[model samples]
Target: MIAPADHLTPDALERAQRHLVAKAIAEFAHERLISPERRDDGGWRLTVPLGDAEYLFDAVRAELDHWIVDEDSIRRLVRGTATDLDAQQLILELQPQLGLSDELLPLYLEEIASTLAGSMFKIAQGGPTADALADADADFQTVEAAMTEGHPGFVANNGRIGFGVSDHAAFAPEAGRPFRLVWTAARRSSSHLALGAGIDEEQLLSGELSAAERDRFATRLRDLGEDPADFHLLPVHPWQWENRVAITFAPDLARRDLVLIGESEDEYRAQQSVRTMFNTSHPHRHYVKTALAVQNMGFLRGLSPAYMRVTPAINDWVAELAAGDDTLRDAGFRVLRERASIGYTGDVYHRTAEPSAHRKMLAALWRESPVPLVSGSQRLATLASLLHRDGEGRSVVGALVRASGIPAAEWVRSALRAYLRPVVHCLLAHDLAFMPHGENLILILDEHVPTGVFMKDIGEEVALLSARTLPEDVRRIVSPVDDEEKALAIFTDVFDGVLRHLAGILHVDGVLPEIEFWRLVAETVDEHAAEHPHLDSLVDLRADSFAHSCLNRLQLRNTLRMVDLADQSSSLMYAGRLENPIGRARIPQPAARETVGG
Candidate 1:
């Protein structure tokens, strides 16, 4: 990088001239090879592989003429002082080559004006003698002219350099003592020995000081505000006092204000003992005992009577089975057997076995069935109840039987056949017996039946099956049949019985009147079909038939009101019943009036 100003030698000037010439040649060559063509017909065309074409030749000739004229002007300016030349001519020739445009011209002019203004202001504020001021102003103008001519080489020879001007008077007194100058060998070798100590405003105005001395003089003039620049100046060096600097103490100083409280270790222990005694006397002790029971057993399944009775017993049996010693496992086996017998006998003895008893029995068998003889008997009894119920009961039974260590696939097959095939066949028979292609009954069956018995731990088992799709080493156990089939079978059984069995039971059970029940089924099927229009065919088979079945079930139960149940043909009978109500009211009124008169 070039210094801001250094005396330019003849050789350096010649080198700059040579560089400009070479740049001109390169520009000329580019224009010749890449210039666009203009046709006489007012169209533009680019000739392929432009190798000394006629258009390129004309472009080169034009560029050469401009370059030659500029070169002659530069030569004339270099021979004498470049100050007289038009600044615009030099800018036009050099700015475009330097990648500067007309938009940037104002910024360049502002910078030059600011530079000269700052130098004049600094000299005036420094209180320079008149002669010194004249010389500084003259030097500033000379340097400005050379810069405009693009002869940066000449500007250096004119002794103009940029440097910081410091004001000594502006230094803060409380901050330190004044700094003393020390002449070092390096400063002396650089021919920079003189240093200005104080200002003489009149002397700075005279052209007596050399450029170097004028800079030092300007520094002093700036302090007196006689030749101030556009910006402020700071002292060349500043002294700092240790006492003036702020020191921060440790964080613990703030922490000291916080008062420490609470019990010491010994007191804490004493308080804990008191708390223990109080807690024992509180009603919470019952809750604590119950929580311990649950922890020892397991979490509650549900709060219904069926779940409440079975969950604790099941948990206790599970804990026994999980015990490490044979004694505990045997104890667990005994408990399981007892629970299973009690559950099975409950159905026969009390004849009011909770629906979940079969489920509990199955859960017990699953917990205790590691020993074959004991587990097998439990499995058979549970299976018998489940199958006789047409596998309509709780899922826990099938899960328990499958989970048992019965060592017999036939038993598993029998359980599956009993639960799945019978339900599926019944659904198929009912659906086909009415509407042969109907699949709606299948959907109803799945809703009511236990998913686990049919799908077999569906949440866990399905995921296990999906893993089997991978390579052998990575394969996981899964069901032999696809989940869709399992799901379909489960659903079909439930739906088949929806209109036939479930609606009938609901009527017999008297939970909902038959007409209301049919209305609900109709509304549900219609809304479902409307939402899923694609299932219309399947829905159509069941919609009407199922509604009819619900009506028939309502009739059989005699729960539907005569007005609500009667067909058009039976309307007269229902009308007669309405009249009977009015007649009955009249008979009661006459009796009441006769009693009042007497």
Candidate 2:
């Protein structure tokens, strides 16, 4: 918990506050929550609801009609009075525009505060410039930590709600320190392990835990009035144990349904997405995704027991499909699968047919780490890294282009073909669409050029657009998606949610012209369409513009309550359709014919 730097210093705090204010202003505007008056310089200005306060910023209206604002140009004024930018007050000023309910406003403020603090911490833990990262051969963890912007869509992305300032300093991924995980024992009757094909309990336990460590865990269970064989061990996030499990699950502990075993000897580093931990101690061990009952981004991040039971089989189904496909095999697109999962159902919580955050409280899954899949010549970086910009305004995307020694557009084309083609193939050929956000996908770099991609973090959001029956084992993932909302998965999630920001970043960086950038994206989709015509005609319709489901609006509406993950497809809130930039780019505008003289 050592201070990364002078995090509390006035200059750092002001910078963090101002940065968030700018993001909030731009995001709210883009959501159509507010309309700022256009200024003569082509920038925009806003007077707060109370005429006492106002904000002025330079911004450009970009594709998807996003307000790409210049952070440095932001100015805040108050009652003919002014101070260095204040985000806390800005939240109150935009309260009407955001339309936050009274009950949720205070809680939302906490998220905003935590988010601002995270930005402050990042400022404190400054690292290599984008130029340096672009040129250097950085390891996965090194490059992961360098990523500055947390979720481009959400302004308050790092709101680790349950954490105190100290907890944030210790466990936040940006802290960049390894810590031991606390282990606990759940009685066999209270918990269950869902094994992957050919993976038994013994092999699973021994792989993640050494013999001596297993003995230690078993002995601790025996010391209590329980047989070691009657209980299964579960790893809990250290912060969760200290703040949640020990306090909230005390009754389970008293009945010996859950017993506190000591921390694991192996140290783990928190990955970019906070709850998932990378096994730093054993380089090739499975990455453990744990259930932390904290609100992050839009919902409670607790892993559902009902959902956990089916992860491995779903993953196996995906892997099997990929192996059988010639195009996917040749494309080199691989999924970093969730191979095994274990869940502990508290007797009280399991009484409910549906899963609330309470039922989701204690569970963990083991995702296959990219470590073993990685070779020495090949490197890995999260796709999110491309969005990172250093203090000098150089983007990681700019750096990667330079490092690859390829023309910017050429590098982008290869990266797009590697990423977009697989996603498109899965949709057209298999009726599957993954959650294609940055953190969910890993960039596979061979000698600084993106060779392929590894898709991770596929859960309920991986939609099945088809009504056709699936295998008995994998049927859990096959949900009926309406035609209207089917393309929203790819269009909203991939095109608008992810590529919108990427296009803006690259466009601003001058790495690619805006039209050419979008043209490449359109071309990639058209090529995929040309290759796969046998699947469904809807592919062309989906590739063209589709409905825009407003994701941030869902969070704003229900900040505290569970978004009802059980009925996930129904939970989305839509603000009407956004014209797909790539779709429009792909359509042919008829050429004008020359007139003949009489």
Candidate 3:
């Protein structure tokens, strides 16, 4: 029950505030949601609603309308007196301007506070500088841990909204605390377990839980007057069990429908996405993502029971496609499938409540870890890590590029093969769209040079945009969508959502000029278009431009009431169209090579 006081030092707190204030200014301005007047001194002034209060900061409105705001140069002026930045005060003052309704005001403020606190926790640890992280020579977790920023565009990215100070210390991913998960036995009648091809419960349990752990769990089940054979076993994040499951689903526990089976023998560490835990005890084992039901960003961060039914099938379908397609195989595109899953649906919640409300409270899925699949000396890092700046402001990607011993332009072509090629091909050939976000995509690098990509977290995120003909088993991946919106999955999700920030960071890091970066992207797209002429019927690159969907605006608009998100394309908020970066780029042809990675 100890608080994370050590991580929340005054210096760290102040640094967190300054960092987040910079984010608020950058994101709001970039989204074109706020109007800031340019000043003659090269500083921009954002006036407060209904008053004389103002915020002034030096920033370059760069490409894609990115606000490259300088953190140290930001200040607030009230009645002609200047003061240091305060994130909470800034958000409060801009609440009306942000269009944050009264209903979402208080919770939004709490998220901002939690985000700042999490940032401070990361800062207080005198971790490796960005230069060191760029080296890419550290342990896997060390490199992952060194990522200072959470979501690039999200101002309230680290909002672990459910955690108390004590919970934060014990369970926050940045804490790097390794602990055993509390296992459980849920009656088969009350839960659903889905397994992919050639796998069963015993196979999964044998790999994840040792014989001794299984026996111990069985004993706990027997002690509750139940046979282990009649129940399915699942691991629960200890903190989640204590804070949410124990209290929220007390009826099931008391009725002996869900029996506690003590801690597992294996240890796990949380990934940056708090609900998902990587099996540090066995690196090659499945990564278990559990439903914690914490409200973060805009809505409850819970895995849906509805999705669990088709989870394994969806992954299997996609994995088979990736393996069968010569293009996907040639590009070395891999999907770390969610091979198995178990979800609980309580009668109380099933009949009385919305599935999203309570049926989503308890669920877990096993996604194959990339460690075992990694070939040669190839290492895996989340795509987000590219933008990761260490304490000393060194980028992870910059270090990787430097280590490759190749020119920035050459290295970018290599990177394009690994990252962008697959995405464009996936949409054109397979009629599929992976979330394509940094958190969802893991980058595959060999000797710190781009090789290929291994994607995970598939069930809910990957969707079939054009389901011309799908196998009966794989039909679960299809989401109801129109042609125009389906195309945005590529445009908005991959290009603007991820590559915009990546290009900016690489430009800032001297890896590749932003123009050249987009040029590479455009070339990759054009190459894919040339390769897959038949898929021209499925998609069109000739559409003059695409919608610049507003991600922050979706959260702000839905903060009060989240739209029932049936599909990624269904509930969208587009600010306006920024001209396609790809269209503007003068495409470049690679020197003749056997592979794009060369």
- Candidate of highest lDDT: 2
RMSD each, Å: 47.0, 3.9, 3.2
Query: Alpha carbon lDDT of residue 240, candidate 2?
Result: 82
Better of 2 and 3 by lDDT: 2
What is candidate 1's local distance difference test score?
Answer: 0.23
Off by over 4 Å in 1: 1-456, 460-493, 496-502, 514-519, 534-598
Better of 1 and 3 by lDDT: 3
> Each prediction's Cα lDDT score?
0.23, 0.79, 0.79
Q: Poorest 10 consecutive residues of model 2 by lDDT?
A: 584-593
Q: Write the per-residue lDDT of candidate 3 for residues 369-475, one digit (tens) a residue.
A: 98888766877777878777777767777878777788888888888888888887887776788887877777777777778888888887788876556766567
Off by over 4 Å in 3: 1-4, 469-473, 541-544, 560-563, 584-598
- Predicted structure with the largest TM-score when compared to the true one: 3
C-alpha RMSD between model 1 and the true structure: 47.0
* Cα lDDT tens digits for candidate 1, 1-598: 3322222334434433333332233232222312335457543222223121121112112211111112222222232333222222333444433333466444433333323332232222223222221121222112111111111111111111111122212121111112321100111111111111131322322222234533554454445444333211110111111111011111211321111111111100000000000011221111000000000001111112232223333333323333443421322212221111001111221234444212221110111121232221221121112211111222222333334434223333333332333333222222111111111111101111211121111111111212224333212222233333232222322332222222333333343343444344333333333433432122122311111111111211221121221121122111000111112222221222234557
Point out the higher-scoring one by TM-score: 1 or 3. 3
